[model samples]
Target: MPSRWLLSILTLILASAIVVACNGDNENTETSGKETDGGKPDDFVTLKMIMPGDESARMREFVDNELNDRLKNDLNMKLELTYIPWGSYQQKLELSLSTGEDYDLFWHGTPFVSGYKSKGYIQPLDELLQKYGQNLIKNIPAENFKLDQIDGKQWAIPSQAFTSAGKFTSVMVRQDLLESVGMTEIRTIADLEAFYRKMHAIDPSYYGYLETDRGHEVLWRELSGENLTAFDERNLFAVNEDTGELVNYVESDLYKKVAHLREDWVKKGIIDKNLVGNPQSKIDQENAGKLLFRVGAVSRAMENLQTAQKADSGAKLREYFLAPDKPRYIVAPSNEAYMIPAAAKHAERAMMFMNWILKSKDNYNFIIFGVEGKYYRIENGKIKLLTNDQLMYEWMWRNKNYFTAPTNVPDDVVRDMLHNDDNAKISRLFGFHFNEEPVKKEMAQVLTVYKEKFDLINSGLVGYNSGFSSAMTALKKAGYDKVFAELKKQFNEFNAGRP
Candidate 1:
């Protein structure tokens, strides 16, 4: 028989072996990526990001030829980028997510984050940001993450969105036309109508009257208070932030008022009916120099000016801010962001990449703007844009400190783009995010009705009385009542659960 000390030693050895074997199995199954005893990855990991838009020759060359070498050296990892054509992007991404495709990060928008989160398609970044996103935490404001969180956990990282806290409903007009009409500036919708009438009377070319079909869109919703936020992507239903009351926007008095206002504009010939559903017609009109005025992104005024100048040398475009009194809301859906996949193999590595990109102005410029002289150029402190394909889709990786406008872009337009959302107010629904899962079927039916009827009314193409009647009938049939109840229930639950 073995001595007492010797037997104890053998027993300890066997237990230690069993633990090691069990740990090895669990680590391989539950976790991913190879790591050493020191808790660092044993081998260099390759992280891939997929986004929309086709890759250009120059972008391809820079990624494979130049960018990877630095990435490999600095992070001990390789970054691969892939693009899908915009037409097929959403479909492909959905298929990939459903089928458990292997990817680390992706580009998306804030509104869809709820859909992704509720469906278990994404991962929370609280711990990852704590460990590897120190720079992001330091640079990005804490308030910016409120809307991106679900159940108080950060689910996505908002990239630089050149927007002010509040939405502005502004019009871009041909300054040359305004000058010809002896108008210096337009401050109100009344002044705008006068200007439009004068231009129509003189030119008699209605195509140049208002090109608001596609390239130009009037965000007249700002005329409503910022306290209202959309419960649906379609904005058919909006939640009153102050009261947390769900209001059916399509059925509201405000909706009726705006629909009538637009009907009046169409009747008075201030807005063209032909351009109602024909966006291409408006685009052609703008490019062909027939557009007198349009409502759209004031930030794109420089681009519009440049394109217009090519047709008429004296063409000047001016942007006018229409809403100055209403407080801007900050927790709206973001148009662009970088999100980690729920099944990411190396989420920490992805955060490391984001942190490194934001660590310095130089890194942000390199990653977002690309090789200065080759992809873009800075002349006398003003940056000039060139054909950069990577920067086009990788806009989600942008940081504003490194952002510079092209020489053609005006200072005011640049300010509007950069300082957008600076003074935005937090929504009463700031901490609460509504998940549409419970009413998904009804919401889908509601949207189909909205697209067919409410869209025309919202656009001011149809008169409110008849449009409202038809829409309400269709909405009820599509089960808008069900959407209404679910939204109310969710809002109450969300509020009651709050401290």
Candidate 2:
């Protein structure tokens, strides 16, 4: 009773102390979460992306606004895309990768994909993918994943659009030209050669077959029933089912025979002499009505001709699929992919953005062609027309995936072509990532020599006979034998793991 006032004061002090302790505990829990979970939603984080130029206004806005906004709110991150023109993209990409630049997410292709993967520039997405990429794993099937896996890890994501080789390789002939020549039933590559001879003999003014200088040599290998030893740095050859051993194209006699055939065609003046360095050699000749037929990818050839026809009513393009001519034409993965680099500060966020695009058509189009009204306009229920010249070259590089897959194209001709083609299997190659770190060094030297010499031969720089021998010698010297041996071993291991 004598200490009542003192007791009340002590009680008030203890109650305040208890309140402070509870508040401190709450703050500690939140601080712990922030440290482990990256950052708060409102925190500003910038992700750098190097991609093709933004020539389209609609496309530019979509990247800056729609995509950025969605990513910021959903993943607590933002994107900063650096525009590199397609002509200089490879140079810039190589420079960035070599110098260890602090950027993330590269649109990889034949040279870039293999080159970067070999260099160990990307992270294996196995662990992260298993945890956060559940939807992605479900959408992409096991068969597709098996193709993308290198060694034992996933390096890049395949294009979800048109994974299968849809009647992939075809002869783009001017049907009108064939009808004019009375050659109605050209089936084999030999038959086509006969047509070429007839066209060249009758009128020396036109080339019987107008071919690009880059890949004509390789194409000849296929046309002549010669197996090619095409492999990435992973020492992986296209799997040979007959002998269970890796097939090296240069080791076979058929390769030399194919070279001789190309030389014969060149001697006959059937192929242009000055075609090697000219990027537009075939297209220019075709436009000038100086070409009877040309070789190209089926879907691409048809689309290009359709675009040309829109300008010139007389331009005609039709495809003769290789399957009808050759029985064993298996479509394999083309060397291109999209991936998040290991250095990506926002890799998780970037992956989320990619998954969203896969799920949301609106988002995909925004990344692809830009805002619908600005770059293109929907004419009817099924057509999208490019409205301006500014939008044309905007899609030369990074936006190719839009046209490749799940997005709806309003072009009836393109849609019909896709539906009819056999190689449009986007879901098949989704999960495969090949790892070639062990044989990378050996593969690099061999690949460099092969690419350089092969380019010259296809361009008609050296006599096909001598060129073939020189190429073979260089390949053998560069360790082609060791590479194939390793490839067979790894392939067997990979197959054993598959169900």
Candidate 3:
């Protein structure tokens, strides 16, 4: 027989425990670090970040060694990364946000950008930018950051990406493979098909270009002259810039043509029969002298080709943009940004550490690639890159523009590859941020349908041999119309408000 008062007190304690368990926010309250090196409180602070992959571990080592040990010691600050594996990263991030756990900064862009902003998971960063991050504010072009804003409130910092010639998504061809087939030039998609046909003539396993497992969306972008992507819209379709009207890609003739093109190739045995079921990473096998080309990043294409070159003396890899001859407007935008969470205990201190990292050349390299002579080295004044033998972590964790100083990459190599004369005309449409708040639900639904069915259409599984009309019809049935209408409204608003 417990007394009523005692029972009530016990119940209160139990309820509080249950609440805490459901909230899952103990990490923030439990994790706190002070500035080191006998530095003043104002000079240094510890900032926690959630980045994708174990690559953060290498950054940690660099921060502890190059920055924290000496310069950061007096500043009393360090940058800590809570590594999130890419496989289940989004799930984990969503959990942290739902539970209101503390996160000072995290990597984000594009696919997850609109959703996170709509859910209020990330804070608007305009005030912070205007205040502690003036250096960053000045350095990053206004157009780049403006794309991430909604209603004048900046939610995230733009990641470093060159909008012009540095646009991602290219066809990395094994020059060795092409030469073997007596094909020296590949400039357009049709040329690519011809190359594939040649390779298949030699052997069925020899594909001209292995399509990206999840690259159906890119197919649509190539046909449609639009770069802006929104889930609640026809991914391959958009409002025609000249007409300011909605274009349904799922119903477009281009979709049918590309679909048939892929099917025709599929019949020729040039495309890997197992491609529909293979993961995106499997395309790397093509780089190992198995296939002619793979849909991948130009940077990654070089990385893979460089590896193959080492393994086989005769093997060579060369990259060709989707259309090198004709001027195509590539979607070149930043990919990742460090954003301070609403629950960060020391926002100012976190900003200070970020400022220092962006300002200090040595610290930036350490944070990006890690200790010199270990992850990377400078030989004969050339950036001699090393293999990912444990220390050389995530490649995308840092890039040339993000850090205080560029890595040891050769100037001639960078100029020839990233800023070649042909790519010089590339330009970016900055400040064209699309606010998805009005159609958040529709956007979520749109993404769901795309993930469920678009892969089949793009991989030539469901729409095999059929024209783009059939593919477009399938998407319409999947609720693409609802999504497109919403996107059209927002795009119009964005264009009208453009400066």
Score candidate 2 by TM-score against the native. Answer: 0.70
Per-residue CA lDDT of model 3 for 1-499, tens digit only, reads 1256434533553343333223322222213353332224544556677776555454556656765664455346676667776556778988887677877877765445556766777766544444345545444544455446555455666645343333344566777778877778556677677787777777765555456343433344455455422222234554343354656654566656666656666666555557555543354455356667665454544446445665565776666655444343333345556666667766655555555555545655655556678776766644455644322233433444542212333243345455532433222232344556665676566566665666566555556454344545655665667766776776677567533
Error of 3 at 431 (Å): 3.0
Per-prediction CA RMSD (Å): 12.1, 15.4, 13.2
**Candidate 1: Cα lDDT at 366:** 78
For 141-260, candidate 1 gives per-residue lDDT tens digits of: 444555576655677877654453433245678878888999977566677778888888888774434432221113344446545655534556666766767777767776666677
Clashes of 1: 7
> What TM-score number comes out for model 3?
0.74
Q: For this target, which candidate reaches the highest TM-score against the unseen true structure?
A: 1
- Our tally of clashes for model 3 stands at 11
Segments of candidate 3 deviating more than 4 angstroms: 1-46, 54-71, 161-166, 197-236, 239-244, 269-291, 296-316, 330-332, 387-413, 416-430, 464-479
Per-prediction TM-score to the true structure, in the order listed: 0.75, 0.70, 0.74
Positional deviation of residue 441's Cα in model 3 after best superposition, in angstroms:
2.9
